[model samples]
Each structure stands twice: as C-alpha cells, then as structure tokens.
Target: MKQMEDVITIEEKNHIDELTGLHNLTGILEHLRGHDKYSASEDTVIIYINVMNFKVFNQKYGFAGGNDFLRGMAHELKNIFPDELVARTGGDQFIVLGKSIDKEELLDKLDDFREAVHNYEKGLKMKIKAGIYRAKGTEEDPVIMVDRAKMACDDIIRVYDRDNNLYTEELDKRNELRQYVIDNFESAFKQRYFQVYYQKEIRAVTRKVCGYEALARWLDPTYGIISPAVFIEVLESVHLIHRLDIYMIDQVCSDLRDDIDSGYAVEPISVNLSRLDFELCDIMSEIDKCRAKYDIPKKLLHIEVTESAIASGADFLGKHIKKFRDAGYEVWMDDFGAGYSSFNNLKDYDFDVIKIDMGFLREFETNQKSRIILASIVNMAKELGIHTLAEGVETEEQYEFLLNIGCEKMQGYLFGKPKPVSEFVRSVDCSFENNEEFDFSSYYDDIGTVNFLNSTPLETKSMEIMIKLPIAIAELHGDQVSFVYANEAYIDFLKTIGAENLDRANEIGRSKERDNASGFANILKMAESSYNQRSEADLVANGYVINTKVRFLSRHGEKAAFALVSRNVTAQKEAHSADDYSAVLMHLLNLYNRIDLFNEEGTFENLFLCGNQKALSDIERKAVVAVQMYSDTHIMEADKERFKKFFDITTVHDRIESSGKHYLVDYYRSALPGDEDRILMYIILPFHYNGKWRFIAGCRYMDELDKLKSVLKQIEST
Candidate 1:
C-alpha cells in the first residue's frame, strides 16, 4: 500500500502546477481526455478566465507578488467549484471544467469571482474576463475546446465593461479567418495580390485635384476581396502590419515611377503608417529606400499618421514625424476630431495638414452640432497655420458647407472613389497645357482665407460695408461662368435679374447667348478680357445698372477664375455716367512708368507697365522680381542697393506693423539711357480689404508729380 501511494504521489507531481498547486495545461488536457464525464458528455462546460491588465499589476508588485495573486485566484476558483476541474493554464489565464449548469448560475459565479478580485487588494483594481463554452458533442482534441473558449474570452477582454462572454460559432469563423490571413499574408504579398488604390484630394475652392492618398486593396484568389477593416486589425494584432505598410510604400513609389516615366503629371501621394510600423522596423529608412529605388521626389511622397497613433505614443510618433519632415516629406494628421485628445495632439506635434474626421460630414445633414464643430475646427486650424482637409465629403451640400466654412482641401466619393491606379489615371485629365506660369501657392492661400458665409472684416465698421456689397468667385471655362461661391448679396442680385436663383444665374451664364452685348454673360465676357490683360475691369450688366469690378484670381490650363464685386448704382447711373470718369482715370494712371500690386505675403497680385521697356516688360509677376526689377534695371549703380533696401518686400510687413503707416515712399536716380539724371519716385500704398492687406506700388518720374503739384498750386492762385 505504501509503494502504491508513492507511485500516485509521483504521478500527481507531474500534473500539478508548481506555483499554484493546481493542474497545469498538460495535466488538464490529460485529465479531460481520460475522464469520460468531460470528454464524451455533451453536458460538460469549459470556462476560460484571463486577467486583464495583469502586466500593470505585475509591474506594480514584483513577479513574486504576481505569483501570490495568481495563487490566491486559483484558491478562490477551487473554493467556488470544489467538484470542478480547475487549472492554471498559463500566464495570468486559468481554465475550469465542470458539468453544465444554468447560464444565470454560471454568471452569478463569475460575479462572485469579480467581487472577490475587486476586494482582494482594493488598490490594484484588476479585472478578470471569462469565456464559457458548453460542449456540443465529444471533442476529438481537448486543446481545440480550450482555444475556442480563449477566443471568446479575447472578445470580452478587448471590450471594457464586459466581464463574461459565451462562445459562439462566429468566434470560430473569425479565428479561421484570422488564421487564413496569417497563413497566406506573405504568399499573397509576394504574388502581387495586394494592390494600391488612389483617392484624390481636391482643392475645395477650385475643385481641382491637388494630391492623392494610397489605400491598400487585397484581391485574394480564395477570398476574392478581403475588406481592409478585417485584415488590417488581424495583421496589427499579429505584429505583421509593418510588412503591409512597407509594401504599400513600395507599391505607391512604383506607380509614381510609372507615371513619371510615362510623362504624366503626378501629384503628391500620401501613404499611411501603422504604429506597429514604427515599433517593428526602421520605417523611415524603409520609406527612403523605396523612394530612392524608384528615384521619386521626396515632395511627391507624403506621410499620414493617425491622431490616435500620436495620442497613443506621442513622444515616439513625434520623433518619427520630425524625421519624416526633416527628410522633406509632409506629414499629415489623419482623423483630426475622432479622438478625445485631438487638440492635445495638435499642440504636441507638428503636422502639415489635419484631416477632419469623416464623422462630421457623415452626420452633417442630420446634426447641426456637426457643422458648428467642423467650422470651429477649420477656423482653429487656419489660425494655427495648419491646413485643413474634410474627409467623406460625399454630397454637394456637404461640399458647399465645407467650402463656406473655409476648408482648404477635401477627399471623398463626391469627388472620386478610391480605385486601382490603372483606373484612376484613366479618369483624371493628365494632359496639362503649358500655360504661362502662375502662383498656385498664392491662389490656394486666397482660397483658404476666404469664407463668404462668415467673412472676417478689416474692422468692425467694415463688416456692415462689406455686407452691402455683392461678391462672388467665378470660374470661366471658355464661355461658361461657373460661380464657385457667391455672397448673400450676390445671390440676391441674381434674384433681381431674370434668374430666380444662383443655379438659374449660372445656367444663364452658360447659355449660348453668353457673348451677348448685355446682361450677366456680358459682364463675364468683360471679366474674361480683363483676365487676359491681367487687370481689373469695370463691367456693366443690364439689371439695375449694376457696376461690377472683376480681377483675375487664378488660372489652370484653359480655365481662369475671377473675383467680382458688384453694387447697384441705378440712382448714381441716372445722375451721371461714371464710365467717362473711369476711362479718364485709367488713362491718367497710365502716366506711371510701372505699377504693381501684391498681397501682404509678397505674392504678386497684378503687374502693369505703360512703357515699352524690354527689361520691365520681361519682369515676372513674383515678389522678388517685382521688388528688384526697377532697382536692378533703371536705378543708378550707386543707388541700386539703397533702392532695394528701401523697397525690400521682406521688411514691408514689419515696417507697416511697427509704423502704423499706410504707404512707403522712396526716391532714386535713374540709370536708363537718356534718363540718367532723372529722379523717380517709388510709392507703395497698402490697401486693406476682406481682412487682408495689399500693397499697390507705382514708379514714376518725380518731375511728373512736381508738374502736377505746380499746376494745382497755379489753379489755387487763380
């Protein structure tokens, strides 16, 4: 009898867990396999318990404390079900097998376990999640049953506020799908089953393609099409997301190379990076390698990091983002308002663009709060000097709302859905006309600053003055005048005309009689002519004798955009014809040798020259050229540096800010042949409008102004 007892003790030692004095995984499997009550009975139940955030507890206490906690948990489980088979499977997880009981009774037992855990330390605040699986039939392998229970437990583990879950067939299906993705991910990646799709990012004001975002699509042979939502999470869990991210970068670079080699105009393409990408590899080095391999420009490839990613690991992500930006890649913050710490993230890191969360647009029509929040976000981003892009803009109403709120960029199905590169390239008009060089940065700046619905006034008094004026932004393509935006007064003017609404007015603008000698179309035609001349024009339309002033805004290919301001002048028109005075004033202005206009940022607004000087005529409409042209060409060698210093575009803003001055004046000696002894006056007058300042500068012989002053003095004496 003593010898037999020793044999039993030795056998039991192999089955027992050293730390908890409970059955280990191997012991549990062997016991279940031998016990017919569990292996063959359909009434048996398996419960898997996983301690959530045990690492926190383990770190708070030492490993020995973690062992003590586990042993205590095991003792509690045994006390709760003395007749059941209880085991400490592995690493803060335990398994219990027993005869099936009522689910409510089992839930009561779980509640008791939770209460006991909560009371165990009070300071620890650790929680345990359980997965319960009832046997459907005899299992060939007990390990499969254990895994199924663990899967169900995992479902609850990820979800806060949930302590217990029941195993279902769907869990099995999900497990199988996860396994499939893991098993075939490498094979599919090498076989070229993964393709990159491009979704266009549009300039909100111009409705032109500015860039694209690269999205991954899996064209699996067996699964046909696996949603990124399904596979991305699985890959992230398995730490394989870095491979997919690098693959996407390589694919995007390859496509861009193809486009460049084909002589197609390519825009910047942004590739998304997972947090795992940074942890698992040197993602920046990998991206640089791919870019160099394809010989792609750094500006053409952008990096997108999610707001949550930054919020999760801010210090780590901030370093990576700085590296990317230092390498000349623009890093954009994706899903701006999706998380609670959005403003915190913005404050903590630098991002070139913030993609407003799609949820705002999705609920735009139904929720009024969304509009308020979205508008606030756009305004805040603008004030911070960060660009804003609205995502999921899928309707005309949404697009119009975003535009009205001054969102700079947008992307969604309303513009174009994500599609394979082959299809996307076909849809876009890649053939760009080699038109005269234009300042696109200035154009985008103007677009971003304008919000007709809520325009920023130069002063409190100017708000009322601006409200009375009718303003609009019109895009002219041949004879068609598409109103991209119109103020309330402009829309009201459309009502005064035969057109009842803006849509009707645009239809009339697009009519066959657009070239008529009168009406809105005639005004558009006048604006078109003015755009060609690169000057503002006085336009007359039929209704109410309205006076319109149009100035060139921007141009792309054959399309030109104009900003128009109109007012009803019927009373003034009946009293006098202002056209005569305007013509006389235009001729008077032509007396100047050179005139140029630029915004506060030193972006050239307009350039006018009255003389046939080859050097002056050849000057480009750029800040540097406009500021230095006269000094370089016509000023005396001794005065050239002085003239440049006095007319420096860089110091203009600071001078204005410090002096509260509206104009700057400088006089220099001329270097031109036959005008060597002539003194020229360069005058710059700063004009404020629509919450911005523009400098209108003119250069003329000082003698002309002296002669006019003498004439005025003579007239006064008479």
Candidate 2:
C-alpha cells in the first residue's frame, strides 16, 4: 500500500512543470477535463497570461534567469489565486483556471499578477498580458476555451498600456481579418498584389529629387489595397516577411529596369530588407541576383538597414551592411533616433546616409526637448561625414527647420508622396528630369509660366494662369467690365474677405438688361468710360497692394473685353521679402500638389487644388473628390458620423496644442469612393485666423503615415 501511494505521487510529479513547479500543459488539460466530467460550474474561466517580449528578456538575461523569472511568476500566481488551478503552459506563458470568478475579479487578479512580475527581481522584470474566457459548463471544449483566451491576449498585446483582455465575440470577428491575411498571403504574391512604390529623398536647400526609397503595397481585390501596417507583422510572425521583402526589392528592380528601358532617368532606390531575411537566407546573394537579373547599375540600388533590425542581429547586419557598401550599394541607417539602440548602432555600423526618423519631427512639434535632440543628431551626423536624410516632413515650417539645421536630404509629403510604378515613373521624370539637374537658382524656375493659351474654356485658362503665378485675373465682358470669368487665385482672395460666389455676383452685375442690377456693374461701366484703352493702377485692398493691369481686346471670337491682372504684393511690405510668403506658398504648392482646408470649426476638407495634374503623386484625388462629394451632399450619414468621430476637432486641437509649437498629424483616408483607396493626409499646426483656428492640410498617399503610426506604437510599447 505504501509503495502504490509513492507510485501515484511520482505520477503526479510528472504532470508538473520542472522549472516553475506548477501544473504542466498535460496536467492542466487533464485537470480541466476531470472538472468537466464532474459537471463543473458554468462560471469557471481560463486566464491565459503571456510575457511580452520574453525573447528579449531571455537574450538579455540568459536561460537560467528566464527560468527564475517564470518560477517567480508561478509563485505569485499561486499566492494571488490560492484556490485556482495554475499551470506553466509554455515559456513565459501560464494558464489559470478558476471557478465562480467573474471578469472583474479575473482582471483584478491579473493586474496583481502583472504588478508582481514587474517587481519580481532585478534581472527578471516582465510585463504580462492576460486573456480571460468564461466557461459555459460542458458546452465549450477546454482547449478551445484556452485558445479564445489566447486570442484575447493577442488583442491586448497590441495595446501596450493594457494588461488584461476579456474574450468576446468581437475579438473572434477580428480573428477573421488575421486568418484572411494568412489564407491570402501566397496568392498576394502570385497575383502580384504586392507592389513597389517609391518616395524620393530630396536636397533640403535645392528641393531636388535625389534618391528613392522603395516601399511595399498590397492591392487586395476584396479589401482593396491593404496597408502593410495591418499585414506586415502578421507575415513576419508567420516567417513570411522575408519573402515579401525579397519580392518588394525585385519589383523595385523591375520598375527601375522599366524606367531605364523607357528612357526615364534611373535614380538610385533604397530597398529595405527585413532582419529575418538575414537570419533565413543569404541576403547578399539575394541582392546580387536582383542586380544581375535587372542589369541594374551598382549605384542605382541602395540598402536601408532599419535601426531595430540592427539591434536584433547586429553581427549579421553589420557584416551585410559593409558588404553592401563594398558592392557599391549606398547603405543607409534607416529610422535613426527612433529606438534605444540608435546611438549604439550608429557607433557600431558604417552607413552612407543617416535617415533621421520622422518621429523626431512629430516630437519636435510637441516637445521642445526633441528639437534639441534633432539638432544634435544632425550636427553629429554631419561631423561623422554621414549625410542626413530627414523623413516625414510635411509642412513648410518643418522643411525650413530641417534646411536651417543643415539636413542634407528631405523625404516626406512636403516633397512628394510615394507612387506606384506607372505613376511614380512620371513623377520621377517630371520632378528630377525636367533639367539636367535640380535648378534652385529660382524657386519658380521649374514652374514655367503657362503660355499654352488656345481654344480652352475661360475657366480652364483662368485656372492655368492662377496656379502658375501669384497673380489673379478677371475677364470682363461688355463696357460694364462685368466679370465673365475669375481665376482661382482671385476667387481665393475674395473668399478670404467674406466674399461668396463673386462670379455669380459678377454675372448678375453683367446682366444690365435686368431690372435690379448690382451697383458694382454701374461703377464698372463708369470706370470703363473714364479709363484709357489700357490702364495700370496700384489698387490696395485688405493689406495687400495689387499691381493691377487692365487691357481691352477681342479674342476667342468674343466681343471687346477687359482683361484684369492683379498681382499681390504683400510680401514686399515685410522685412524679409526674400522669403516672400507667395514664393514660399508657391514652392510648397509646387512640392506637393494638393490643397486642404481645416476650418475654425475643425471641419477638414480636401480642395484637390495643387501643382500641375501632370505631376504624378500618390494622393488619391479620386478619393478626395468622393469624400468632397459626400461632404457636399451628405450621401453616407454613417460615414459622416464615423469621420466626425475620427476627425474630432477638439481632440486634434488639444493634442496639437500640447506639442507647444506644432507638429504634423499623419493619418489616412483608407476607404475612399473608388476602387483605388487610402490617401495619406498631413494636417499642419493650426494658426489663429479671424475668430477661429484654421489649418493648411496636405496629402501624401504613400502609406508612410501607416509606417509612422506603427513606429510610434512600437516606441510607446517599448
């Protein structure tokens, strides 16, 4: 009898985790099964707890320290929930089964567990995330219940600040998105939904397109173009991100090859390689294959090694980076100043260019401390003989700040957004190839004055003239000098001074045949009678002096007409007219060709007026137009409500205000009107105008906003 008792005790010992001295996986499963057999209460719940970044802890503290940490966690769990069945399910993961415990009670216990783990030991600190699933007697399988708990845990992991998550039907629905990605991963490659897009790095002072950064995009038939932010990590977790990286580089090579074939200038493009690529395959060989296959010039390809990637596999990354440099590829340290290992990695690695993380700009806009750090980084990089590339720039303020700090290369919405191969090719040719090299002798040198005046509509001709210069024009019909047409610049000026539908007002004034005509019409008739055939005047209005030129001529089979040209000269009044506001505005509008308005009421709208439409950009003008249509007519009430919530003006204002000076708010309009969707918009800091605050918003549909958001989340999590 004694021997048999000892044998039973030994058997029980086999069911326990050796390191934590808790119930093992088999033991916990059997225990739950036994409870089910005995008709356990429906209130029983399984709580799954996972240690965040356990691998990092293991790497830092070694296997023995990790085991100690797990042991301490198990001890804390046993003490906290004395009556519950606790088990060490796997490395840095534990399971707790309790009867008659509600969600709040489970959450409280998990919070205690998290706190205890954080204080466990000097080298054993960890953040634990818990997922809870209440059992429904024998209706649900114990294994499946545990899985549901794990799924909830996974969801909570995304929200770094939270430690506990309750399993719900909604979480299961989210799982569908994940499963869809996994199911369609292979097809995404085969169908060529994965595409290569490029965002050029431009010289800060010259505003010249100098280099291109290759980015990946997925065009899913069902979901449209899925953001890499949504799928990249999933692929990395499933060990498939390396394949995507290779595919992205290959696509970029193909595009470059096409550019060369089509006689477009082939600028060097930097391809980002996942850290897993180095771990899984021969990265150097893969790159060589791409260059050989495309017959790409050695200098035409650049290698961008991310700071985090370097931290993870320093030896491999350092070796490969040097090899890339040796092979004639310009190697860049991407996302500089983004992580804890930033300076350390910089000290260890050799790079041709240091791509300053856009987060600094976001931070600089919000935190005064970030500006000092940014300036320091720029100065240091220059001292080290490394060219600095500032990414995520969106506003004139940021562009000017970076240029002032001597940042060599600038890449962001301010310059241009990333574009697909077909569109990007045109953008590259237009921006960089308009001349032998970028001409910065004059900001408007590339913006040739519109001279193609032909059989075009008056409105079209007016727009062509307005966009190319600071001058506004009004075409008048008859001796009344009635407004038959008005350019956008003039319309904008009228709108600025509480004027609405000046064209309609002018048209009404033009109708002298009407019983009730505007007084302005009679005034225009008197002016026409008094003035010579051509007149010039310095008409001052609203703090701006307009150099007005009027000429009477008959053209395009029209009667004698008055052509009024008004050039704003407000910048001439300022001390620094060299940095003329109109010239600055033109440069900005030229760099990125989209206009957005954020009103005092916090209502933001896309105007879709920018540089020439011939200048290819990533901004989804179709989406902007669709949203504008909806805004105009209120077609989708639900969408309007959703947008109202997303674009909560008060919240945005508060956040921006907290930044002290101002920062760029990077976001995306993912669901748009047409099949092609997801436009990136950058909202600049607001300025107090009239009685309210208004913002000059811009768009860069490159998906870089998604990348920035992901980077910020990672920074917050760590």
Best by TM-score: 1
**Cα lDDT of all candidates, in order?**
0.74, 0.64
User: In candidate 1, which residue ranges exceed 4 Å CA deviation?
Assistant: 1-41, 44-132, 155-166, 337-340, 360-372, 425-446, 449-718
Error of 2 at 395 (Å): 1.9
The global Cα lDDT (0 to 1) of model 1 is 0.74
Per residue, candidate 2 scores C-alpha lDDT tens digits across 443-521 of: 2211111111211221123222113232222433443444433445556655543235566445433532221222222
Give one digit per residue, the lDDT tens place, for model 1 in 1-718: 2322322433466777889877788877875677444443677788999987688788788898888889889878877776677888889999988887789988998888877776555397787899988877767777878888888898775455688999988888777888899999989988999999888888876677777899999899898888887688789999999999999999899988887787656667889999889999999999989999999988788799988778766688899999888878889999888844799888988888999989888778889989888877876776676888999999999988787666888899998899886674443445443111123634565545444433432111212212445667777776456787776767877666445667766765554223222344445556456636333334434323556666565666666667676655643554347676556668877878777777666667446676634334344656767657756678899988888777666677567546644467889898888888789888876543333556678888988889999999999999
- Candidate 1 clash pair list: none
Point to the candidate with the largest lDDT.
1
Q: Over all chains combined, what TM-score does candidate 1 have?
A: 0.59
**Predicted structure 2: clash tally:** 1
What lDDT does model 2 reach? 0.64
